[model samples]
Target: MDRPALLAALRARVGRLERAGAAAALARSQAGVVHLSEDIDAHLPQGGLARAGLHEVLAAEPGAAAGFAAVILGRTGGPVLWIGPDPDAWPSGLVRYGLSPAELVLVRAPRPADGLWAMEEALRCAAVGGALLALSDIDLTAARRLQLAAEAGGALGLLLRPDTEEAGPSAALTRWRVDALAGSGGSAHSLGDPRWQLDLLRGRGSTPRSWTVAWRTTTDRLETEGGTLAAPTRNRRRA
Candidate 1:
């Protein structure tokens, strides 16, 4: 082959090798667990929520209950199945959080037990990307079963309960107590107000953390505050 042609062939071969090496490195980087980070890293374990299998959030009040579930479902970005005690009154804010109204499948059960069962089935469906199950109350056994189903389907599960239901054993990967805080509106840079404060209660391989997050319904974004709570505290007595 001509000298110029030989040199060109050699350069192309070197470029291909370099690209292959880069791809290999990228694959290795992604092989491990990947947590989702939405601007607030310090408040979360490793700067993101663990995306491994199952996670739970328990709210201390009705507002917090609905808002926390919405935040978790919003982050999944997949088809969500919400099973509630009553079909008539579904949490409207969930739709505002970017969960498509069409993407959400609401199943209303006459009783809390039936609702839990329906939620388990929904999470088991491969077609379902994620699920948020809101119950008036769920016993420890029911929670454990739901957790198992979530793990099997590789779907994220959130159990929203009243403050009274917080006492019990749970199979959830993590339990978060969420509260709605008064928020101020102004320039975007300043941490306007405390929209929601989340307290992580339990998780394997990770310590608890607290976060101050703002939910902008119009923008469909959850902005993490520049600051987090001073210490992790559990209001189990109240819940």
Candidate 2:
């Protein structure tokens, strides 16, 4: 193999070894990192969300994936710019997930092509804390463009793609597939806080895994059941 290819392989091996220790992972998470729960953090090499990185989200159903994105934005604790074909953002609906409509800036593009353009431009703005781009189609080239822009501006960029969009190739730091599930509302008469089936399909320096988590409206936190199975606990805070 060439020298560069040999170095890349060595780096990948080192990353795997670093993520194998649970105790070391826990320490990194506690030291000013975003808490995604112990189980989830253990699987991530960084033990938390990568700052100023691009993440791609896909859903079996449309609205379900968007809800999960709201959870991420809430944790980001910054203003969000959503660029899509329509203004589907409902401030009241997003409150349960932690993002208030007041913190949102909606930009409606006439077409998917236009939305992609707007997404890159928005990521270049320093004032924009986070950005979500809803596009029906994006190739590897386009995806890399968005990624570079986000890295330059030091912001998080969420590429919201359709369920049919095959997860083939991309430059995103992480790729997630989110699906909503029905759950007990605590009481018989009402629906409970939104529950979702989250799949980490791909991430740099991490293994792919799945988990079920629910949004707790009262505290604006992601309630997980220890990891993959157990009962929900409300101790974790979103921020």
Candidate 1 clashes between residue pairs 3 or more apart in a chain or in different chains = 163-239
- Predicted structure 2, TM vs. truth: 0.77
lDDT per residue as tens, model 2, 1-239: 44355346534533443355334333432343344556777777888766567888886667778888887766655567787889688878877777888668777776777687777866754445578998777888988998899777556789888766355777999888777778648666888778877777778987667788777777776776546633223332110
Q: Write the per-residue lDDT of candidate 1 for residues 100-151, one digit (tens) a residue.
A: 6755666656567667766776565444556777765666787778877866
Q: Residue-pair clashes per candidate, as listed?
A: 1, 0
Compute each candidate's TM-score over C-alphas. 0.71, 0.77
Our model 1 lands, by Cα RMSD against the true structure, at 15.1
Candidate 2 residue runs with Cα over 4 Å from true position: 1-35, 186-188, 229-239
Most TM-score-accurate candidate:
2
